[model samples]
Target: MSSKAKLKAPVAAKKPVELIKHADVRVDPYFWLKERDSEEVLKYLQEENAYNEQMTEHTKVLQENLFQEMKGRIKEDDSSVPYKKNGYWYITRYEVGKNYPIYSRKKETLVTAEEIMFDCNVEAKGFEYFKMAGISVSPDNKLVAYGIDTVSRRNYTIRIKNLETGEIYPETIENTTGGCTWASDSKTLFYTRKDEETLRSDTVFRHQLGTPSTTDVEIYKEEDDTFNVFVYKTKSEKYIVIGSMSTLTSEYRILEADNPKGDFRVFQERIRGVEYGIAHYDTRFFILTNIDGATNFKLMETPEAHTESSYWKDLIPHREDTLIEDVDIFKEYLVISERNNGLNKINIKRWDGTEDYYLPFDNETYTAYVSTNPEFDTTILRYSYNSLITPNSVIDFDMKTKQKEVKKEQEVLDPNFSKDNYHSERVWATAKDGTKIPISLVYRKDLQRDGTNPLLQYGYGSYGSTIDPYFSSVRLSLLDRGFIYAIAHIRGSEYLGREWYEQGKLLQKMNTFTDFIDCSKYLIAEKYTSNQHLYAMGGSAGGLLMGAVMNMAPELYNGVVAAVPFVDVVTTMLDESIPLTTGEYDEWGNPNESEYYFYMKQYSPYDQVKPQQYPNILITTGYHDSQVQYWEPAKWVAKLRELKTDTNLLLFHTNMDAGHGGASGRFDALKEVAEEYAFLLDLEGIKG
Candidate 1:
């Protein structure tokens, strides 16, 4: 028998489950796959995994070569630019050959002896999958609290360590969001806990050092399932704030850091469709909000004594073209990160009204953002800058003198790699609605804009999250092999401003899919690539994009990759038990509502799958994913396998021991990337 015939695809049993809602009866044949722990489900997943292995067996050598090439470009013995916080110069460095970071701090001076805090390499020794997050140091600099997740499901266990004594305490807080805020007293901390079933961060608790987590006091509980709660200390270190936020509205409660046992007071009441963020500075709180129909957002401020919306006065009035993305408060200046004309800008304004200017940037398609500036009393404002061709550089700019220093630039160790060898540009593609969508592209300078060149287009146009054009060393594997990379700034993203995002969500969500299709057509029409040489990629919600585009315009691409894709929109949205469903109603709309139900069914990838010749495709998912459940893609692949007419490649990979983000090890994550790159390259007949 032929090798392809010997390795047959896994056929999932069709156990029809009728989902009735709003007078709509949708019959789901592979709904039984959601029963995660069932023996049948595990067996099917294993069979599919086995089949994927057999189908890709020919490319194992290429995958390994790609991994090594990518790994070689990274500087393994690297340390991040240390930023001072609370009298300590904190630094995170990685040792050569180590898979995790080593956190340490210096006393007062950068040259002082390094005091190692937590060596994640040592902490992650035995676990198959491990992740550590939210390492918070106490005000006194003696105690530290961090969260650890061994299961890869995102629910972390809070652990305390004595930095002075180098001893780990026995107390453990379970099922938390892996973040905590310290009170003035080093003995006390406030943290947010997640619900066991839905994994929603809905409750905040105050815990005392050396006490059992069971004795931790429940400070507040969010009764609304559609909102999530988090606890954090303001940059001013004056208040411990509890923030409750939904998609469209937010409310905050604050208590003085010195008053750990005192009752918290509400900062502001939540109003529907109003979203605001608070940044504390001295006796005043700066607010960034969409109040009074500031669609692109505006900045306001209120006295510390009067914490209400009525007390808010405009510090920077609403501008039609600018979206106030964020504000970083310092002792003498307010740094504003905003987006205008699809470009990122950092505006520095002096409190005394002496000077106000934006940091100059000349790149056509680049990303620049405020980096870590923990100290409130500094003239230097640190930020990072990068582009499709430029390596990432961390810079510190003096707000007073306007002088800048490049602290460090990413070191791509590949001897053949050079930024000058690549060219980057931004081009606009006309969408179906006559809207101009920007597409950022980078290719080797030697590349010709001919139809023979291969091109890979990527996008993530949901949740107003703008996927900026940034540098990547791993991408060299594709570019060096004669491939052009492009990022389509579709409407769902806030690339052009808040209005761009508004037009791409809710009932108008089809614009996102159609916008991507238009971008692909533009690239083809421009002769940068032909439909036979074009490929597409996206993960998470972008993975949803991949699925939708596959159904809408499969003929436009030669291959596609969907990583942990959210394909079963109608079913996942209707089930509130899912981790992030309830909180995302403002994003994908509530499918329980008849209008949204019918609207989602019209474009929902799984529901819209039809018998057609699909391009070569690969779908990746994690067994322990807390975000998009593994079954969405599993059932999606099952349905596609049953209905697809062509015998083109259809591969499904499940990271058995990982979750939404995939493998925890630094090198291990690269292996997944290497596999993805290999798949794309193999389809193009490229071999090392």
Candidate 2:
């Protein structure tokens, strides 16, 4: 990159605005940036982008090289492992030069002729950003209903097409959630619609083929702003289920798939703090829920006729250390996905209790989860496995024979790529509260323990989402460049169990930030990397983590990257109009209350910006991001530029054509990764 030292940062004009909530007064100088599409906001964003471009001009070739290096590792002409569903084998493949996937299917046998359902490359020709979701084929396999989003804002337009005639129906449904569930007759489908303003999926609609979407009947509407509703057909293909859920509770309604025009009856009323998920198996429904204070969740089964909690009987009791994640029911076997301590475990049990066993996985830090097993009568169960140093492998295990076959393993095409060249391990860091936080690390075998090597730490602790140690081809660029990569499995995520997540959210949110800081300190103390060479990165909620960490311990890192970050916590939570605000109150406490307002104000990234020296920071956001609005990062950068004492590089880049995810194309997205890596590498004066 150019001598960033010579470049001047863009100055965003101050337009102070006072926001009062819960008797608290706050002055925001750059709140004007939140005015979407306004001339002033547009100009300021453009100027910042221009500044970012100029500052990193010298890294143009390096960026391209990194992009190509990462792209080279991917098998360009590759097809996913075909899985059978509803008498057809569905396959998703990509051409050598195409940036999109081509969806196709075959008849009962693999030798049958292939029928191309959707070639996204052709559909994406005119749009800078395009996404296709919810490709649901009719029960008879004659018609397909899908949702298309050209603007990348998560709002889709649903359309239907006849597979045999290759003609699209005239009806187009707008503002949908991009997935539809087909009924037995193949003429009726159920889809969820989003509220135009808040973008919340709040209503489910039933659409009849050959009819206008305007005339479609509303099946159900979620009255609570905190909840969202979705419709889906069970794997058993007998029931169409409508699920309404929030951060803490869930409710479901079911109707026979054969009775498309029938009224759906509630299976179980939603109770506060009681979350449950149902799976159909012949005469019973298997539920995974945290009922009766089972915080880690348990598996229960009840007759299809008696689908209330009162009739529910425990099939697999909850254990304090193990969290039952999900279940897949088969005719002869029952599969349970669980997490114990910090690792994923898959347990298989026979229906008659003849055989019960857990799939054995031997790795210090790896991820394993059930893949597609849509057919209920099949004895084979498919699951995926991968680790920091291992490529993903799709394995199929026969429940009856107790045997497994490797269906397909992800191919890393880079000639120099070899799993043996890298080493991965799990280590624990002690937190301030005497909690042990797990850190997963991967590095070259010839690494030195002397703190001179550059290190990049990554973390995202929010929403009870577990960030497992999965392999990434793009990450190889950093490892090859003499950098040590670490993933901090801190609090706010269900890495250990549900309790781990509970201890890190709401009032206990500070634990997430402190756990990360403690992990950094442990790495430095162990001589893995010094403070001068240490760096951090995260995106979205993790981006929130990056913001909080830099404010809490800026001196511990040489640089940081926050992507589509949710930094304005207090201001966002106070406004229920924002897309995710209402739904996330249970995750991040509602700021309307004085208790939460004061607590959130303490750590909200934008609120905590002060006149302090910070590490070189890079912030990225998308203009059309409906989840984490683009203005969060824009206002944050403006505030940091005004308050930070050091002249360290602080760059912001906004993708004009994309949403929370920067770019739509596979190769195009790598360019963003290249830009991020180039920024970190350029700071260390490392160039190829």
Candidate 3:
């Protein structure tokens, strides 16, 4: 603990900048941090990094121990379950010492010699930050296309490797979406490209083999700044799709894969507020849409040739209680992923209307979803299933016989770990508005309800994204060490239904902050943990949750970890050049309008910082984060340091080489988690 006094936290020099929106004026003192490469900004960040090192120096050994403990539980030399696609069985395996996966495939049978398609470990050798994505093989199986991002900005370089010749093509397409969809001809490939500055995916280009990327044809372009464009092939592999989507609407274009050069016709034209996604079956397309007042979404079908909003006929009519998250179509069965009562369920129906049943889940808070089922005629359905106390498992179910078999369950290498040693359950906490929020709890089986134990509560309630209760090996580290971990299934997510999301967005955004605070209060009242022992952690938008909660109820927790937080809400939304500003206008109202401007300033963390007490805080950011610029967190910590009354520990750390995700390597990212764990445990007087 003496190390905490060795260095003072960095104080950013202020240069007030005035921001005016809709005739409303506000001044930001730490706005100079927005200069990505300014010397002053770099110096400030470096000083903060040095300060963090000095403050955490006492826990360095403890951090390493936690890292090694978690690392020990991972089966480093592991391989994914092989799935049959086209004519090959694809398996992504990791060598004992490598940080990346090795993609390989075998023809016809597992006994055959494997072909090494792409060795990501070798490709990622010298780069400080490296990520490989979108491994797609040609339909003919002679070529492999993949995207690699070396700078950690998410803009990938599309490369082609000839499996037969073991040579990478001389031509490389840069600044793509890290995905490539191949045509049926195998010679042509399509990928989405991003703008140079805004980094929005706006164009889809078609590249033919043996030709320079400079000659690639622009197949489509989305002129709308709010919408992003991406290209993919349908599950049927019959057609390539170009989708343009914004916050509240979407439109799609389709071209037959066999006709690579054919014009892509609009499957559905954009409507003001309608959003829909399509799945291809025999001769029709199933449309999942939020059309006609379907708050929980609905499904409709239309003839493939008559693909239009006006031609869609009702298939599964809108249900107010059920949200259709995804769909998988097969020759004789339709598998639907639905969420009802905040639980995930899969509905399987025979095409002949003979049988319709839901796949059962015994755990109240487990996450289950359809896995890779590439074949259109297969009767076997593969799905992923897991809960807070269960290891991740891949289950294969036979639709005809309703037989289930476990293909694999993640292995925790530690012999002391057991599912019987832990306990998990679902509970409801009433918010201030009488809304019952679901919270998933997991802890050691011997946990005592004496309110003396340490608890870490996590939440993310934005973007209509549900924070499901899933198993994590790293979580075991805390659970084993007398920590109760809970996930607050708050609003701003489609957990209960679409209405849950609607109630926490735009004008109602404060509900999200209030809900998290209410959950914490409930836990404290129920004797789970007290204000002196509770810890909070969340990332990105959830980090915004942490900032807002700390402002609203500072004494509720002992420490808070905000990673890559988006806290400078007002200024960020005012600038459309930021990565997601324009697209998120509907989610977070446009601040250019006076009504939204004043509403945003109320809860915007940077603007709301006051001369008050705050719990121990650790904020981490990445220099190249594309989603929320690093300056958001940089300015947030600065303002908090300047205004907060209490002399509580406040630290900031920035990853100099990485982006939003923190670290590129699997093991390297665990180090960041270990550091946060050490921070929390150190505050609780549990130093290794």
Candidate 4:
């Protein structure tokens, strides 16, 4: 027998279950796959993995070649630009062949003796999955607290290191959100913890460095299931903030950063429909809020001492078209990150009352956002900018002199590479509803607008998450080939402003799916690509886009890739025990309500699966993923195999060790991308 025939795809056991919702009856035979970690489930997953390996064995060489090609373009022995924070220039670097970064710092100049604070390579020695997040140095610079997750779940354990003694404290805080705010005293730390079942960050705890985790005091607890909690120190270093936020509402409590035993007071009372963000500046609290029908969001200022909604005075009034994405405050100036006409723009306003203006971006489609402006008194504003054709760049703009310096642009080590060899532009793709969707695209400069090119169109149109056109060195492999890469700025994202996001979510959720299909159709109509050689890719919530588009317009593409997709929407949303289900009701709507139940089922990929032809598909998931459970994709694949009539290659690959994020190591994650690229290239008949 042939190797492919010898390794048959796993046939999941049929355990028919009826889901009657909104007066509709649906039978799911693979629902039993949700019994995660069971022996039978594990065996079935293993069989799927084996089958995937067998089916893609022909592309193993291509995968390895792609991996090496990507690796070759990276400057491995490289370090990030030093940014001064609390009397230290924090620098993170990677060695010749290390899979993790070495976090080090110099006291003064680059010539000073380097103090290796955290060698992630050494820390990740034995773990199959490891993530280091939320690294913060104490105010005194003598202690550093960091969060680590070895299980691939987002829950992290807080660990502290003494810079002077080079010793790790025995006390550890568990089930945290991978970050902690340190009191000015340095001994006290406050962190948020996840719920035991839902894994939502719902409680904040105060811990003294040497105390046992058991003795930690619960500082605050959010009672609302729709809300998640987080703790952070104000930019002015005056107060530590405990924030509770849901999809549509927000609340905040503030306590003096130096006073761990101090009482916390509400910054603003929570209103059912209002959403606001706070930043401390001088004696005023600057609020970015969506109050008073500011659909696109606006900036307001209120007294720091009396932070009530009534006390709020308009600073930057609501504009129907402009979206204030973020704000960065410094002693002499405030930098605003805004999106106008589907493009990012940075505005600088000096406290000295100088003329305010925006930093120039030459590219038609690019990403520009504030980066690492740590010092309160500094005149330099550090921001990051990148585009489809430009390398990621960090710029130090003198907010005073109006002069800018490119501090660093990513060193793509490939000798034959040049930005001039590629071209990037923006085009509007008209949606079915007459909405003009922005599409960012890049390809070889010499490429012709022919229908023969293999194209990958990507999107994530949910949760107001805008997918900016950012540079990727790994993407050069596709560009170097006869391929065009495009990002469809679809609805459900705040790309065009809040209204863009509003129109794509809730009852309008189908717009996100159709918007993507329309962009694909536009590309094909414009001769950039044809459906015969087109591909679709999205991950996490974006993975949902991939699933929906596959069902709605299966004939539009040749293959589709869904990464850790939230496919079983109706069932997952019905179960409030899932990590993100409750909080996402505002985004996807509460399925318990009949209004949303039917709407969600209409697009829920697993629920909508029919015995029809689907493009060749590759679904990836991490077994330990808390955000989108592994069984989602597992059950999805099983259902597809049982029902689909097409003979196209269908695959389900699960990383047994990882979670929401596929891999934690720097180089290890590239392997996943390499596999994805290999799959895309193989489908296009571009064999290595």
Candidate 5:
């Protein structure tokens, strides 16, 4: 053939390397510690000691650089926006950006700031404690209930604050407390507390406001030893709903709030193959469920009796390829957030069952929280939107008038910032079994589309999680430096609906790993990036994804950072003594059983590490981590050192204080991110 003709001919794609069978995979005793004699391995853990010194220097530099860069950018606004509630306005702002401060907005005039409430930082002694995940406000807006962490990473204490008078009532509880609710009369506050030893056990407590008693009345206690319980009170303040969870799923029950302390009746029986979320509407309970194994859900309402036999009505029927995210009941309508065609839209449906209206925003905008005041017939929708080059914009939308207002627009660094500088596209790749997986790519537009760019891919495909489009200031730093950032929407995540999540979890869990590999390959084949310059990162369960991908296709990535990873799956799954393991048996099959154990052993990162080529890795953990303990990553690194063929660096850094999350403050968090990015930059040979 002529030289010109030969050059014009297309080249065939490379085939994926077949996975080694579990029985055939070999282990190397000195895989990671080849440099050390067995005697040296026991002699002060030299590798670990070196890693600690390196990490200390790395963290110190990262903290200094991040603080210098972000000090001027930290918004310190003393002005408090007036929020009118129950005939009065409350001004809320942060004091010194360290504690939640008090500012009152009255009659459009700013009142003198007073210390009406104390934040967790003030209540807890130390730099480690973080505030509770959620907060509640009383109907009359007089009492505010919030939770605080006391036992480092294990326990939470619910505290009540009287807004009228700057006083904190009932300082703490010994157990883990959450889900705070206030009665309509505002005389009593309700919250849920649980024992740290029993993962699934919890009890609901009611404490009368203004009382100095150190004890609380127990309204309800979950009796089942095998089931976990969660409780929430309706916004109407009429009923309390309790959700009971077994290894597989959960069941919801409802109780009357008139007595405020009574037995709850089973509102919905434990339906097999369904997940439910409960909301209240018009003095009735509306439960959203994915019954019959359909990934999309339908709304079922109990308008009268709090039992399965009660008159059941369907508010919204399930539709294929569409999933409802959240539903808010307004005065005469219901606003539902639904995801379809890879975009999220808000649909307002009349209570009379007619579709009133639909509002759609750019898919890149992430609507994190929605709030509505039915009394004023107004709604406040909070959202943040950004892209590869854009920083972020936090906007507020008025639902009734369909008008949008900018609340807090994230300041872009410079006029040089432009989305045209970078491009983002969504593509799909087929996994090992022909399952189509979605992947999002963001890269510099000027870079050659010849698979030569340095790429950093991320994924978290578990727990029905959806990694939607959201802006990251730190990520912009990578994009500006010509690094491609991609997200693999693998199975075990609800990104593509329920079936996508189900297909990726449990015995079918290997799909998450294979899907990530396929995405990496697709990026190279499609000329988006090259395998030589590729890096991967994930944390928590996502960290497990990172470990799996590294083991299955080590050649695909040059660097991997697994933070607080669930690496020792087999050991963790079988050990009931660890926190959250027993409760997570449903998500990951119980390893106590032979079948489950065998399935988990097949892909457990720490168990599967063999003497083969591997990539540079940085594994991080927290000493006080309750979810995934420090021993997991520590032991995984130890085992990897014994087995890996490649001499690539493997570093482990354990946070002395903190839980599953490694950082405690904003600066601390930024420093952690900067350090991780520094490692990636160092591997990619990109000088910061």
Candidate 6:
């Protein structure tokens, strides 16, 4: 044969090595369903507990080591300083200095090192229960009301704290409650609570301050499962409005202050769509809704002839492509925060429809929150803005004068902590079917992009959740250690809008798994990391994403961490007795339907795990997790162990006391993070 034709006949084209199909690598259906039974499930759960005990001890050690190393560098600084009427900022740092005062923005130099305002200590303890919850401040800023978990654990109690007196009044209530509104007199506070025992219904209750044992009377009650009740007071304090959610829509009922606890009649119902948010202006209720099929929304005003079926006037027409994130009614103006092009912008419009103004900022991320101020004409606008390389900076802006002053710039780390040390970049990847997805990455800039660096990819693509850019302290540990941290803004999230969410959920759930795989492939192709050093982590719905990705591309990751994952889709969906299963049908699709059942079974991680080479997986859940039951993860790990062909490590950990979130307090929270980080480090071959 000639030298050019020396290529041997492709070795008989290697008869396609009997590729195993998904159906070919299946498990016994009876073993998963009727045969194994609850007792077997319990046995698996016990195994999970045994594994968790070891992980917990290891995590404690890791945390102690980290704390010891960082103790010397941890500087004491004043935090959450409050502004006084005298225009002085009161601040307190228990570890460094005592209570102290600084000049206000109006009097102090913008760049001065000294003369800061309000010397108040950061109340870390009070934040344990309200870490991820909302807080309501009184109109006069004298009292603050926050929700705290009651003895029932599932239930929450609204507690009002006297800011000046340092006193707390906790009121007992049911589960799922928010929107605490203070009466014009400030003596009574109104809030909503869901009575899950009564078919998971919602009820509104009014509580008086300073009363601990007094049984609060329920003002209104709704039977529909979807009806969520919220209480809000008008800007003029003339009326208190109660809003209710129905199966396909929502309605609002208004009652005068004199009869706040009486049966409120519906003043507006289904004026536009099923979801409506009401904000009170000068004796008028401004309703925000998408009544005319416009995704963006319009502001409708309730005319004096307000009734259940009354038509509303289109006060603010729907602005194309602009969604109003939040709206606050100040004295003579309406401050609206609109999100456009992934950035928050504030627009102030005169109540009389005269003048409007837009404040410009260079950053892409900004949040403006209205601060309680006594002055009607002027409102204290507190905002924080940051970018990829910039640390957070808090500012106070005066609406009338358009005067902006930096209230507190987050203390940047020492010169040793250089932004150049860490690099953040955005990249796009093509999915299996040619869908392009965006992914954000953070890693050590000095690290070689030669597929040797350990990479941890995270994603949460569900529930209209937007995983936006924010600050994280623990991420610093990974960046400093030359580990690449990447977040895939996958489809199930509202990052790209509602359409993105619609495309990634239900029968199209496979899109999420495929998208994650694409991100991993892109990283490998770009020489960011090799499959041997890649790890994936997620929690809640994100946890489901982790499990699916691991099943779909086990060869692409060395290890996977799934916390409170909803893995057992078939089992969980079949059990309607669970707390959230019924309400989640709209998002996950009812598996009882034959079409949905078949489609879901296809991608359900717990059901899809086959006898194949699998990556090391560490699954964590909470025994008290009402959202995603502990059994889901337990069953998933047990089934995987029985079915997986490879002898890879599969560990399951369950928090016995905590709920969906594993920890409650600061130390506990830090410990959870430490454990997660340690697991990733171990997989990535990193040493403390």
Estimate candidate 4's alpha-carbon lDDT, on a 0 to 1 scale.
0.92
Residue-pair clashes per prediction, in order, are 0, 1, 0, 0, 9, 13
Query: Worst lDDT window (10 residues) for model 1?
Result: 1-10
Candidate 3 wrong stretches, greater than 4 Å: none
Q: Compared with the true structure, what per-residue lDDT tens digits does model 6 show for residues 1-688?
A: 1431332211111112221223333333323322223665545556556655554444556656654433323334435434433232333333353222122222232243433222222332333332223355665656767665522135455566676676665554445553488766677777777656432436777787776525776788876554556777665567788877643367887777656556667776454234677766555677777666646656778754464335677877877667666677778778777666555578887777778888786643333434433234456666666544445667777766779888766565454666666667778899888878888777767888898998989898987676765545556766777788888878887666555666888888788888988999999999999999999999988988987887888999998989999887766776666656665666777776878877877888887888888998888887667677776776677667667887566767766556786666434555566667777776665667
lDDT of 3: 0.92
Of 5 and 6, which scores higher on TM-score?
5
TM-score of each: 0.99, 0.99, 0.99, 0.98, 0.86, 0.79
lDDT of 4 by residue, 526-588 (tens): 999999999999999899899889988999999999999999999999999889889998999
Q: Report lDDT (CA) for all predictions.
A: 0.95, 0.95, 0.92, 0.92, 0.68, 0.65
- Alpha-carbon lDDT of model 2: 0.95
Give the per-residue lDDT digits (tens) of candidate 5, residues 1-688.
1332222211112222322333344342323322223454333244464554554453456446644454335554444334555555555565565633343334323464443444544654564646454466677776777766643574666767777786777565546555576666677666667766644446777777766426788766777554677677765556777777765556876766665656667777775555677777666767777765546887778764554634666777888888887787756667787777556667777677644777655545243434434333445654445554455565676665669886666664545666667777778888778878778778778888877788899988887787876666567667877788888888888787777878888899988888999989988888877878889999999899998888889999889989999987876776676677777777788876767778888889878887898898988877667778766776677667666887676777766666776666555676667777777776676655
Ranking by lDDT: 1, 2, 3, 4, 5, 6
Model 1 earns a TM-score of 0.99
Error of 4 at 217 (Å): 1.2
Model 6 poorest ten-residue lDDT run: 8-17
Q: In candidate 2, residue 536 scores what lDDT?
A: 99
Candidate 2 per-residue lDDT, tens place, 249-357, comes to: 9999999999999999999999999999999988999899999999999999999999989999999998998999999999989999999989999999999998999
Error of 6 at 566 (Å): 1.7
Better of 1 and 3 by lDDT: 1
Q: How many backbone clashes does candidate 5 have?
A: 9
